[model samples]
Target: MLLELQQIIVHPGQQMLLKDISWQQLENILEEMGERRAARISYSNGWLEIMVPLAEHEKDKEIVGDLVKILLAILDVDFEPFGSTTLKNERMRQAVEPDTSFYIQNQGAVIGKNRIDLNIDPPPDLAIEIDITSRTRFDNYAILGIPELWRYQKQGLEIFLLQDGQYVKSPFSPNFPNIPIVELVNEYVPQCLTIGRSQAMRNFRSWMQENLQ
Candidate 1:
């Protein structure tokens, strides 16, 4: 078999950008790339960004994702977690694979489903990105109309809520309006690095319990 020129190598903590990529071309690339790939993607208009996450990026993604899950579980909210699932809309000319995503308010919409078609199905309620590599781009998520987005970078978290068609930085997540999510990220995520993940999670749960009570 001959080698395909389509192969490209993206290093961790780095990103590659391509221009004038058509929607059909993007679809073909996605199909060829398969779903289990480690690289995350963000496409808007005719621009595509391919980002390869570093190991630290994955660690941060997992920890932040765990934090979100814990928050939902403690709040007794029904949610479905979609980790790095490709979300594409041909009409909108946008495709995004977030580090982690959740269907909270729209959890029932995707219950017991293996595949998600963004054209027919509702988008995830909240999407989280761990930008340890600082290579994440938000245009696609905003265009895809994800209601809430949490961006964690360098041990800090920022919540962006979709009010109209754009994302607005907000201190509180609509899903967890009463909790101090930013502070939670600043506090426990670092604790995870120091005390280890399991202990950090335990402390976070206890802290939430004390605060929420």
Candidate 2:
């Protein structure tokens, strides 16, 4: 059992890449590791990468996640938020644990699902990734077939929409069809830093209701 342990640390609170690891092996590793705050595992083509997020990474992740929630609330949209839930597809040879994920258009499909099987269940309508340190490949998410992905890095956000078996950088989110996600994140994330998350969220929601309504 000791010999089977093939872990190597590339950087503290960053990434650990392993080669020739099977899906079941990766599952075993995650199970043995148990629950960890802000830890993410990804697999593609027999290569597995484990990520341990840092403090700044989590701060940005929370800010982006909060903003999305506020926007949903403002629009009176029906959504179910799943934070850092492990998503995988053995057939696709892909897996990921997003910083935050949501079911909006597909909300009813998974309302009572205790275990999600991507082969049958629809993937998250939207997934958010905060890339302060470790970068997630768009190709991996593309393979997973998530409809929308929001990636934040260097205070900039990029929105990717899955189309025709590939990801395209889109100006707007498919989930929030009317909103410009990049502009929204840039404008409001800083306000959270200045006025605090709760206050900023409150103010943004009020503004949205007044303007959007």
Candidate 3:
């Protein structure tokens, strides 16, 4: 504990890993950091990583999240969005704060609840992470039993479905099997920068309506 938590500085697009951090220490650190901070964290066993996302990272996350909301609305699917909520399990000694998470099939389970306890409540049906700043740890999500995860990096979007206790890369998301999400995001997300977020979303909506049928 020589290096106090306040002394640790994680620059944008950079991350720091601390070793041998106990579960209680992690809890204390999380409490100290507070809920509104910009940094995100992941813990596995005794290892903890604190990451500060870059500006592009935030932009990417927003655009993709908007697109997801549009999809859910059009499909008339009931869902609840949890943005960067802390999901942790003390028994598993694993924790992650995703860019966004959604309760789709299990939406009713978390309604009106202020907190989500993985020990009792079901894991999010879909988890989204923008990997521009730091790579996601699949082990944490897999161990948590999240059914699906979307990872968007510089290359493009990737959809992974939990199958047989592991994430298998797939071209389509289980929730939107008829649509090609990877292609849609890659083509539309950049439009947020060029034409503005609102216009980009409108265009995406028009495209969805015209093409979905």
Candidate 4:
């Protein structure tokens, strides 16, 4: 049975904490929460947390996600985006749904697979988390061994890379090692909100073609 379930209201949304939950229980919760895109659920070491993402949180998520995709396309890189897909490792007792995830170098590994088993399959190459309402637990992702993580909070983007079994603050993304990760996100994300996504993407593509050449 689920234990120590409590709800905390945070002005715009709610977060529920459940303690002493088993890995099986966390899997059950995910099954029950299927297709509920707004819910952010994380479980680690017998603890479970559920959060309803705030509107502003989603706005930043979209902006960042779009910017990343634009970068991949303009650079002619192969990638598969899995937006907010639940990633779980039963043996590790850890699970999380990133705001946006991508299979970059390992895209072919997950192709045509209906279900991913972390035991064998490689985890997403990059994961994006937007922290506006509630902060994500970086420790959990570290345990999951996701190669790179991008976190957007307080109008600033932070990049972290997995190194020596831990996440270290990174100045450049492993995905785009030569480019400026935080600067690109900061400049284009807000511009998308101002000029509309379509126009912003078009302009960005044109600029990238010229600059990247």
lDDT by candidate, in order shown: 0.85, 0.81, 0.91, 0.83
Q: Residue 75 in candidate 1 has what lDDT?
A: 82
Sort all candidates by lDDT, best to worst: 3, 1, 4, 2
lDDT of 4 by residue, 1-213 (tens): 633323434345678787998887777667766765578888889989888888988888987898888889989999888888888888898888899999999999998765666778899999999888888789889999998998998768999999988889988987997888788777777787799878877887777788886
TM-score of candidate 4 on Cα atoms, chains taken together = 0.91
lDDT of 1 by residue, 1-213 (tens): 744525677888788888898988788778887888778778899998888889988998899899988888888889999888888888888888889999988989899987777888899998888877755566778778888888888849999988778888998977888778899889999999899999999999999888886
The sequence of per-residue lDDT tens digits that candidate 3 reaches over residues 1-213 is 387788878899999999999999999999999989999999999999999999999889988998999999988889999888988888889899999999999999999976677878899999999998799889999999999999999889999999999999998888988898898999899888899888989999999888874
Tell me the spans in candidate 3 whose CA falls farther than 4 Å from its real position.
Answer: none
lDDT of 2 by residue, 1-213 (tens): 354443644454668788999888887987876765446888888998888888878898888898888888878889888778877888988888888899999988988765566878889899999887788678888888888998998759998888897888888887777766788788778888898888877877787778788
Q: Which ten residues in a row are the worst by lDDT in model 2?
A: 1-10
TM-score result, candidate 1: 0.92
RMSD of each: 2.1, 2.1, 1.3, 2.7
